[model samples]
Target: MTFLKRGVPLGIAFLMGVLMAFQYYVPHEHSKAFLELMTRWDKIIAGFAVFIGAYSLFHLHYTRIKRRAAGWGYSFFVFVGAFVTIAFGLYNGGEAFWHDKKEGTMFDWIYMNIQVPAGATIFSILAFFMASAAYRTFRARTVESTVLLVAAIIVMLGRVPVGALISQYIPVAADWIMGVPNLAAKRGILLGVSLGAIATSIKIIFGVERQYLGGGD
Candidate 1:
């Protein structure tokens, strides 16, 4: 506290912090330069942040192995995954001076064939699980709950032709749910979210928030 309470860090933080906040409102050439400087600073900080995360990943596994913690094998899994990906992604093709050989092609293969299907499979299970959970937990506990459960079921069936064939009511209900009620609710949510974002941006501009600058304790 003694050193930092009265140091160069405090002065720089106050000055840069003012420019960071004011750049959002100020329209002069000076404000433009300040904004550009902040943008570059952001990219530089992000690069260093990535390095810090990588170091954390490496250190965590190394410590696990050193301590022989239970389920340490899982840590090895992370190490193996990272090493394999890096190895294939680096040496699979000849490298250009600047062009990345495996970034788009090889990594994308791993993502699509493996990650995308896994994600979809998990998402597909949600319907069955939702039905079971609603049946067990909801049980039409109240008028509001009953309405919610019915609405969920109707929307779920509306996506498929089978639902329409089974009952014509489903398609109509789904149309109302999606076209009117759901759309209105989504619009309200989006508007609220936008307002929140604008408020946060203004706060950062005014230096009311310094969490992003690593200046917080």
Candidate 2:
């Protein structure tokens, strides 16, 4: 059981990880073919994973509703929304199920009218939280923080029309700050993230990271 649950998966992960990593540098036609084949396999597996994920989501809400857990009423809406969406999708705007969905379909209507508006409303609400966070962050408590606050203010003002009326230099300074300092910081962060990802991948390939297998040491 240990071999089946741990050793087999680890070996497979190591083999596949190393193969995929090397595939990027191998300019051979055989390597290209192998990559394409693996890509197709990945998509097929992902298709099955979607169904598994949906089942897991449904079961979670079903259990919540059954146990009458806190916010159980919201679980009912999950079922309602899912079923309605699936039904509309299958209906395919009165066409056959196999046919591709087009505009003016029931599925499109639900997505555009219901889901899009709901998503936009949620995003709009997040603006207030962002503003509150900005207010807390731009307090100018220290020298470094004061510089950050000033830079943020310049960037914000430069983006609007009033700043141009005040002085052309403000916009130029803001543009320079964003194009130079902001870009440099972003690249540094990205480099760190890339290095971290490479380290994690190496760990996974060497079986030093077993958290994905439901065990960690």
The per-model lDDT (C-alpha) reads 0.78, 0.92
Kindly provide the TM-score of model 2 when superposed on the true structure, using C-alpha atoms: 0.89
Most accurate candidate by TM-score: 2
Please, what are the lDDT tens digits per residue for candidate 2 over residues 112-161?
A: 99999999999999989989999876787899999988998899889998
Runs in model 1 deviating more than 4 A are 1-48, 96-98, 102-109, 125-131, 213-217
Return the lDDT, model 2, position 13: 96
| Model 1 Cα lDDT, one tens digit per residue, 1-217 | 7456444455566677666766879889988987888889889999999989988999999899889999887898888877766665665545632455545566567767877998999999997998787778977879988887888879989888988998998989999999998999999999999999888766665556556656444
For model 1, the run of ten residues with the poorest summed lDDT: 93-102
